[model samples]
Target: MGQRIFRRVSLGIMMCVLATGLVFAGSPLPNPPHKGEGILTVNIQGVFNAKVSLSPFKGLKTVEPIATVADVRGNKSAKIKIPAQYFPGEFLLRLDYRAKEADAPYPAERIIYINQQNIEITVNPPYINNDEKTKFNSGEKENTVFSAFMKENNAKRMPLDLLRQFLLSYDQPKSKLYTEGVKEFEQRRVEYNTWLANQAKIHSKLYVSRLFQFQYIPAIIWSGDAKERVNQILKNYFEGINFSDPLIIRSRELSRFMDGYMGLYGMQATTVALRDSLFTQAGSVACEKASKGDPQVYGWMVDYFYTGYESYDIKPGITMLQKHINNPDCFTSKKQQITQRLESMARLVPGALAPDFTMNDNIGKSFKFYQWKPQARNKLILFWTTTCSDCLKLVGELSEWYKQPANKKKLDIVAINLDEPEVKIGKWKAVIANLSSWKHLHAEEGVNSPIAREYAILSMPVMFLIGSKNNVIVSTPGTIEQLVKDLK
Candidate 1:
């Protein structure tokens, strides 16, 4: 379980890395950008025509490069002018380079901390973090202190983690070795946490110091079963965390902290019902803890659980979020989304009238959803996109199902295309050409279209079964089998 926490931290960082997209600009560096903007000079070696980019971590989302310098040949440097809004935090420096002149460009990325100071770094792209191959300015404060802190912190934490593992796994609980192990574990945990706290205070003014509390090891009860131990961990997980400090969200470790917090509840569940119940309880506990702090943090907690609950179709968990979303002080950006979801849950349930919507069919015919009466008992409205693989799969299944005479007599399919950017409209035309038996309509603005908002279509492959009587939603079937089952 301790190991799981560490792994989640790494997973969080990797997720950030994977979601990031680097933008390349052909224009030269800014003459003088935002006031007090720092200068970052990157000297590349052993690669020709390298592209260097700099990005900063914002919230718990994908990162985009604020500046990029392309065509940086070997032994030459690229000067990237940092933007003022992104400073005083950790940034990712990425280098896309070719070892040989004709070889394809391979990318390498390294995390670098920046404040208001002008800093210069030289690196071999393939060996970006190699102490001998990469060098930072000797006068650099944030990265220098951070690099040293990582080494020292790891050294102090290694033995403590080892002792924890021993205490959890050791069979001879009645023996002196077990007792000695527990004592050593307690001693090391205290020493590590004490050092962690002091370091956090000592470097409180530095941007990197925001990450220290992530390393603060919490107390554990090694004397219980796994479930009991998880409960104890849940109780002590937020021991030293300061949720009131909004700056903590700028670090990737906060997501990792969230993962560990959520993972505890996940580890305890043996069935789907138990999982939903525990997750609902988890949301209540975690959100309550965050609600007492910064409004942004509180909103972040709500957004996190809302995403989880919606993705898992956890109605109980989603309902448990009403108080958090309704709180006036919570400043979550997802407020509109949560409100829409809650509204959707109430209005789109079985037997409720499906909202009327207008859309243009494939041949530019205006189609009003409620006015049309199909020659079937039910009308299945599918909100999908041509590019979605799942949507394509469901289309195939539905087409096959529709071929059966009895099934076709019972249900009519109307697929609402949510393809975006205008380019996908060509693909939509090509796709619907084959499914001539079904009605196809495109929402010009995709997910943001008014019809989509009315239906609360958060993701693709959403379906609503409308009865022929008054367009009331008969069922919201997830699969063709479910649709068949519901009709039966």
Candidate 2:
């Protein structure tokens, strides 16, 4: 009896210890345990299965996100671990919580500065300067200059917005409101421009592209005369832009700004031909500027337009793209990426013959994607991965459409899973259990699947629709809604 009592007491002690450990593990500390390494910790609350990414501010380009954490649960306030590898610089830390709940309150993004110190961030929904936690740290002012400039620049944009309206509103330049608005706008513009110019002087580390946009957008827009403004923009659109600066060429915003400037340049264009001529000349002059001055700039712009124009079914800059692909100055990998981009984009376009491939279904049945019955309906090929949070959401969306009896007969879905072998198919089966009624296939070599290569699956949740007759390509639908609309 004594031996039995000792065993029971020991078991109770073990259970107590486990319970304590579980509680400690379940409740994440405000910050991750500092291991004396350079791991930057992020504590997230009120969100689940979030994707944490860091995009560094090294150049004037869109810095592709560096995925620090793929999917993290929000329960118990999770702490994300990220080691700082970038040189002391500013970066955008984005928490893509779309994978979790749609109504999650956390701000999607925040700017972070790495100063060779282990930084800790506590992310909660509706990120405000003050609520319950610590106030905004003023000690880190130099690190925060980007946000400050952005705020100031946004505040000063009212004058430009007014000027644009003034240009568009009045045919008569002599109207009292238009004249006075333009004059007042011009004065504010000078003051704003001076302020932007001094930002870099104030914070030596301020990104040049940010300052350029804040400066040039105002200088070009807040003019007193419409015709003069148009001419000034067209003639010197890229005057202050230093193409050699890696920041300008790398900034996606700069390219977006250029795209907008062309559209905004001649808002009161008299004819369709006039607008076309203006845009065509914009591209031509942009190319010439790059060709003569900065080859890198020229190459970057060629890529920008080649990829950009193709999406709208407009192939304006193919010649330039081809030239850069063959250019000696271009890196082999970039050239390859550009070449692949052309081939894939050109192939997948509407009316192009759909790339054909064979893959084994969930039941080990080999099926050809192009084999659709002549009398049957259109075909929809969905490329997704088991681990892709977006893809999981997409499956749910498609499943909803498919549940309707009408959609099943109107469209045939060929769901392809790009989950590798080592991950095991059990988890994938569990995830796709809801869509069991639909035909699903698994790639033998996940990412290197032939279909993915043929279509160039650069991103997840990519869908293709094919016309029933001759299996002609229809369109790459962005959403299930688009696919349904196209079917009609």
Candidate 3:
């Protein structure tokens, strides 16, 4: 009997492993996509189950497979047709070898361009297939040009990355070595820019291809006093960008570029107040440059910049929109979106009072979030959900900290569970039971709750520190320990 049972278990295991392999062995999508939709056909090099995705994915990463296009068990070759609207834009085609399998190291993702043509790629590694040809059929020119640019970029970027790293290691204006490094870096930049210029001429039709490369120029210019060259170069750098091109607005590359640009320029500001000021000035400069060209392009950029900063420090973004987005009515549709973005942005900045709402607790008791309810004390308002594994651990840590007798009277703690109705309250209640000292409430409509929308609560678990006076938001900390330290 023991041997028979063992034999059955062994057979079951074998079947399971075989089934997993077959599933990832290049199966067709269940629902066939039409030809009009953007199609991707790849003759891959390896025979492993790989995870592929289309970008611009959120936060520069795809945590889960986007089943619509690239999330399949791609073996040696995989073909997929995307929606037609995804064309003539820049996108990243990311692949992770053995991604579905456990303990695989995440590799650097590769970016691909879409030039209103069906994409066909041959994915043999250069080492394996010496010529590194594209085995699949269409969009050969697009792939070939991009392949060369990428090859050149990698070769040239090694020195730049090392120089940039070294420059960042020292104090910016204080160190002579930093100054010397910047001067040397400019020589390399000029050399690389000349090469890029020659390529841009050859691939003139693919001018949109250069916007991202143009965006990669480091914004590390700093001076103790006003430096003419740095200012002039930055001014020319932004001005030369053809925001008149439709592709500049269609792609998220500009948005991504502006974020890093703002960070770099903001670092030059010695004070927090000055940082915000510099960021606002940078936005104005960016918008002024775009508005000087096409209204449609200008409007699109403004809308995108505003949208990008919704979860970020929104004041400078708001300032740019309000001050510089004064375009003619030709862009009426875009103006409306920008207006809506402004209204939302106006309410979500730090030091602004948090809006109030009422929600029921486990026993139907009402909890109100308003000014001065938890009198004479500051508050830590955490927007959390039970379904999130990260939130679970975070809440558990905060609960553990709350258990200490020393922290009980430190401040009032508000934990609003925004878990969907489908998720049983039992899990939420279990977490709350462990955190007995805190005021617990349920977001009546989960993530879309009125309070959540008022706060622009897109992701969790986000925390806002509220001051005692006027119930104004004091800080936004990522962890419980940070919140504790901020409170102290």
- Models, CA RMSD each: 7.2, 16.9, 13.8
lDDT tens per residue, model 1, 17-120: 21101111112222232376679999999877698998887544538888889789999999988777676666788999999899999999888887657899
Off by over 4 Å in 3: 1-35, 48-78, 94-110, 123-139, 153-192, 212-233, 249-253, 294-300, 303-320, 323-356, 362-411, 419-434, 444-447, 454-488
After superposing candidate 2 on the true structure, give the runs of residues whose Cα lies further than 4 Å from its correct spot. 1-85, 93-109, 113-141, 144-172, 198-213, 218-235, 248-320, 330-334, 344-356, 368-439, 444-447, 457-488
Name the TM-score of candidate 2. 0.56
Better model by lDDT, 2 or 3?
A: 3
Please give each candidate's TM-score: 0.82, 0.56, 0.63
lDDT of 2 by residue, 378-438 (tens): 8888888877776777789889888888878787777887777856678788877778766
Better structure of 1 and 3 per lDDT: 1
What C-alpha lDDT, on a 0 to 100 scale, does residue 135 get in candidate 2? 29
Top candidate on lDDT is: 1
Q: Give the Å error, residue 94, model 3.
A: 5.0
Displacement of the residue 147 alpha carbon in candidate 1, Å:
2.4
Worst 10 residues of 1 by lDDT: 17-26
